[model samples]
Target: MSDLAHLPATQALKLFRTRALSPVELMTAVIERAEAVEPRVNALSETMFEQALEQARKAEHAYVHGEPRPLEGLPVATKDEQPIAGRRASDGSLAYAGHVADTTHPVVERVIAAGGIVHARTTTPEFCCAAYTHSRLWGITRNPWNLDYSPGGSSGGAGAALASGTATLATGSDIGGSIRLPAAATGTVGYKPPYGRVPAMSPYNLDHYCHDGPMARTVADCALLQNVIVGPHPADVVSIRPAVHVPERLGDVAGLRIAYSPDLGNWEIEPDVAANTRAVADALATAGAVVEQVEVPLRRADVMRAAFIHFGAIFGPMVAGVADAHRDELTPYALAFAEDSRAALARDGFLAGLELEGRIYAVIGDLLDRYDALICPTAGAAALPAGEDYVDTKLTVNGVQLDHYLEYSLTPVFNIAGRCPVLNVPSGLSSYGVPTGVQIVGRSYDDATVFRIGAAVERVLPWPTRPQL
Candidate 1:
C-alpha cells in the first residue's frame, strides 16, 4: 500500500470511495506527519487528531454504505484565523492564545459539509497584520523546502503545508496577497477568487479587500474546493450570487489574449525575480497565448502609500488600545506602527489616502477593460531569511532601495482593484532554491479566465513535489 502522505486529496478520496483505503488509515498517516513536522515548521498551533479521527471513522462508515459527502474522509488544513468548532482559533496572537471557538466559521462549515476532515490550524502573523508568518504564539513557520527561509504569510502555514505534502488542500484568506504571497514564496498553487466569489466576513474592512480562498498543489484541486465553498451566503452580503461555472479541463493557452506586465509598469524588480518571471511570460507566448508586454500606468508610490495608510488607519487604533491595555505584551514594531498611525491621523493624512485609493482603482479598472488579463512577478524576490522581519531589512530591487517592505509591492494591486481573480503559479526557482511565481490577474468576475491562464502557465514550469520534512 502507498503511504497516505504520498496521496493527493483527490486520489485519497478515490481510494476511500473504492474501499481500498479506510479514512482511519489516512487519518493516521496525516497525524503522524503533523507530529513529525510540527516542531520544524511551527505550522500547526493546534492539531485536531482525536476529533479528526472520530470524523474519519464516521466518514469511513458512510463510504462503506456508499453515502459519502463531497469531501468525505479527505484530510485538510485550516488557517489559524478560521474558526473550527472546539478548536483554538488564534489569529497567531498571544492576546487570543488558547481561545477556543464555540461555533465554526461559515467557511469551515462549508468545507466540513463537503466531507473534508479538518485536522489542524496553521500559523499566521499576529492578527495576520504582517506578510511573514511568525507569531509569539506559534514562533515561526519556516519553508519546508529550506528551513533557513520563511514561508510567506499570513497564509504561510497553508503554503508550507501544501508544499511539504502535509496536506493535500488548505484554506487561506487573502486581504493583500496573504494567500498568493505565501504560495509564491513556498511553491504552492494559490487562488484569490474575485472579491465576492467566496463568503467572507472581515471584522477589519468590508469595502472590498478581504477574500477567503483555496490553496492547493494543483489548479484542479483548488477548483474542487472553490466549487464547494463558493456560492451566495447570507452571512456575506457581497458573496457572488450567480452560479459560477467550474472548468473541468483547462487545456492549452492557445488564442488567449494574455498581457504581461513585468513590474506592473512601475515598481523596481530584482534581476533574478525579473528573469524568472519573464521565463514564465515567454512560456505563455510559446504555448500560443498572444502575449504582449502591457503598460499599466500606475504610480507605485501612490498605491503603496495609500494601502499602508489605509491599513494603518484601520489597524492602528485597535492595536494601540490593545497595547495600552497590555503594554507589557505588545511587540515593539506593533507599538511603533500604532504611534506612527496616530501621528498620520493627526495630520489629516488618512483622508488623502482614501482619495488616492479611489484614483488608483479607477485607473486599474480602465486598464482591465482593454486587456483580458495582467501578469507580473508574485514577489520582488524569493523567500527572505526566516524569523527576521523583512520590514527592518534594506532590500534593494534594481540597485534602488525599496521604500516599503519589498513583499508588498507585487500584491495589493489586485487588493485595491478587488474585482479580479489572481493566482500564484510557480514560474521558476530562485538561486536560493526557493520558488518564484508569476501573478495572473483576470478581468472583473472572470475568475475562470485567471484559472485557465494560470493552469496553462503551470503546465510549462510546474512545481515539483517535496516530501514532508
Candidate 2:
C-alpha cells in the first residue's frame, strides 16, 4: 500500500501506459493510504473516492484502448479554495460552510481535462488568508513528518497530502509563500509561477501577488502539472498570453551565476533552516554553478507594510464580506488578518503600498540583474506546531526573536515583486524532524531558470521524497 500509494506520478503514468499498473489499483492504494493517515494528518477536507475510482477505471481503459492524456490515470488532490461548480467550497471557514461553487476554477478544469483524477480536495486557512492551516470549521491539519507540527498554509493540506502519500499530484496557490511554506514544512516540491503564468478566477487573477501553480513529490511532476494548468484562459483576462513552457528535462546550473541570501538582509533564520540552506548553496557550488552569498538590503517593516496595504484593500475586505454579520464565526487568524488589513488600509492607502512595492522590487530587480537566480530560505523557521495559532505571539529563530512570523519568511518580497518565479525545494530535515527548504528565485518571468536551478539542487542534494509514516 505504501509503495504503490507513494509511486511518483511520472512513474505511475509510465506503468499505466504499459498496462503493468492499473489506475484502479493505484487509486485504491492512495485512497486506503489517505484513509489510514487522515486521523493523524487531516490533510483532506472532503473525498470523492467512489467517483474517483469510477474515473480511474475509465482512465485505465483509455490507457488500454484509447489515447491517454498527460495525467491519465493519476490521482490529483485539488485545493479546496477553488470551486468545482456545485461542489461545496468552504474556504476553511464555518461562515460559508455549505456554500456551493457556481463555476469551476481554471486550475481544476485543466487538471480534469488532462485526465487527472481529483480524488479529494485539500484544506486551507480560513478564507485562504492566513499563513497556517486551522479553522473553526475543519479540525486542525498536522504535519505528516511530525504530527505535533504544521505542514504550512494556506495550501497546508496539499503539502500534507503529498507528503503522506495520499495524493500523487496536488494543485497549490501562492501569494506570500502559501505554497512554498507548506511545501518546505512537508518536504515536498512547490512552484510559485510568476504572476499571470496560470489563469485564475476573477479578482484574484487581477492581483499580481496571487499565483495558482503545482505541488508534487518531484520536480518533474510539478512541471508536468504546471504545463497543464498554465496557458491563457478565456475566463482570466490577466492570464499571460502565449504561455511559457517548462521543459521536462532542465539542464545543469553549471556556469550560471547564482546569488544566495541567508536572511534576505533582515530577519534572523533558525540555525536548522540556515544550515540546510547553506548545504544547498554548497551543493549548487559543487554542481559547477557560481554561488555567491550576497546581501539584499530590504527592511522587514516596509515589506509587511506594503503587503498589508495591498491585502487590506482586497483580501481583507473579501474576508470581511464573508464574515459580514458572521464575524464571530470566523477563525481567530482570519479575524486578525481582516482587522489588521483594515487598519493597514486605513493607515496607508493602496497607492502608498504600490509605491513601496516598486521600491522593494527595485532592490530585488537590481540584484537579480547580476545573477541567474537568487537562493534563500523559504521560511526563516523550519517547523510550526499544529493547532497553534500565533495570532498574538512571536517566535524565536537562532536565539533572536523576530518581530512577527511573517518577517521570518522571505516569500512576501517575491509576492511584492510578483513577476519573479520562486520554486521551493527541500534542503533537508530540521532538528525538529520537519522539513526545511530553499527558494530558487528567478528573474522576472524567467520561470525556466528557477526550475533549472531547482533541478540542479535536486540532483546534487537528493532528499527523501516522502517521510516514513
Best prediction by TM-score: 2
Question: Which pairs clash (backbone N, Cα, C closer than 3 Å) in model 2?
Answer: none
lDDT for each candidate structure: 0.79, 0.91
lDDT of 2 by residue, 1-469 (tens): 8899889999999899888899999999999999898988999999999999999999988988968999998999999998999899778888889899999999999999999999999999888887778887888899999998988999999999999999999999998899999999999999999989999998899988899999999888889999999999998998999988898878888899999999888867888899999999999999999999998998888999999999998889998787678888888788888888899989989889999999999999999999999999998888778887777787777787776667767799999988999999999999979999999999999988999999888888998976767
TM-score of each: 0.93, 0.98
Which whole-number lDDT from 0 to 100 does residue 205 have in model 2?
94
lDDT of 1: 0.79
Each candidate structure's count of clashing pairs? 2, 0
Residue 234, model 1: Cα distance from true site in angstroms? 1.9
Best by lDDT: 2
lDDT of 1 by residue, 175-197 (tens): 78899989988888898888888
lDDT of model 2 at residue 146? 92
**Candidate 1 stretches greater than 4 Å from native:** 1-3, 243-245, 340-350, 390-392, 406-408, 467-469
Model 2 alpha-carbon drift over 4 Å, by segment:
none
